[model samples]
Target: MKVHEIRELLNAKLYVGEGLLDKEIIGAYASDLMSDVLASNYLDEKAVLVSGLNNVQLIRTAEMLDLSVIVLVRGKTPHPEVVEMARENGIALMTTTLNMYNSCGILYAQGVKGFSNERAD
Candidate 1:
């Protein structure tokens, strides 16, 4: 699915990266824990990060992961700096009225698969 499609499906408000709406999303990662995101080997540039946590740290995490899209759940509004940072990093940031669980479910039903972390040990 594309970023714009997800935006429309979730009734999300786009805050940044209007030009990036054409980016393709191959998978999704939903988590409030930054550590979990950092540790996940399943993430790639094609994956979208979904979370309820709204902060600069979330933007930083997405940057570090080289993620192009982030969807903030539960209608949480990110701070000005957070939005600015996402804009600066060329990331597509959006917010949805749906909570994290429903957001994931909707995406899943739309054929958006979650990033699977299969332990090698």
Candidate 2:
């Protein structure tokens, strides 16, 4: 799915990177814990990070992971610096009224796969 498509599906408001709307989102990773995101190997694929924690660290994490898009859940508004950081890094930032779980579910149902660290246990 493209960034714009996800925005429409989640009823999100774009806060930055309006030009990045056409970016392809092959997968998704929803977590408030930046550590969990940093440790995931599945992020090698092009994906979007979904979280309710609206902060600069979230943008930093996405930058480190080379993620091009971020969806803030539960209608959380990012701080100005967070938005600036995203803008600086050219990452598409958006907010959705949906909670983290529902946000992930909506993306998943649309065929967006989730990042996983499971080992087939």
Candidate 3:
């Protein structure tokens, strides 16, 4: 799906990178634990990170992992520094009022995949 498709499904607000709506989202990742995010084998070149952690580091993590979009679950807005970094790094940012679990559920229902609870060996 595309970024606009996600926005349409979630009724989310694009905090930054509004022009990035054309980007392809192959899957979604919902985790507050950045470690787990780092461990996942991401087949999706574009991932909509659904997390409650709103900070500049999250943006860095996203960049390091080559994630395309950051979806702030539970209405958690990123700080100005985070926004600046996201802009500088060309990362798209969005926020939704829905909690993490529900947001993940909705995205899953909409066909976002590539998550497994099992840990990497």
TM-score to true structure, per model: 0.96, 0.93, 0.89
TM-score, cand. 1: 0.96
For model 2 the local lDDT of residue 22 reads 87
Residue 36 lDDT in model 1?
A: 91
Candidate 1 local lDDT, 1-121, one digit each (tens): 9999999999999999899899999999999999999998779899999998889999999999899899999999889999999999999999999999999999999999998776342
Best by TM-score: 1
Candidate 2's residue-wise lDDT over 1-121, tens digit each?
A: 9999999999999999999998787888889999999998668537889998888999899898888899999988889999999999989999999999999999999999886776352
lDDT of candidate 3 over 28-121, digit per residue (tens): 8888888888877742447788889898878878888888788888887778898899899988888888888888888888888745554363
RMSD of 2: 2.0
| Candidate lDDT values, in order | 0.93, 0.90, 0.81
Q: Which regions in candidate 2 have their CA more than 4 angstroms from the true location?
A: 118-121
- Preferred candidate (lDDT higher): 2 or 3: 2
Residue 46 lDDT (model 3): 73
Residue 83 accuracy (lDDT) in model 3: 85
lDDT of candidate 3 at residue 36, scale 0 to 100:
81
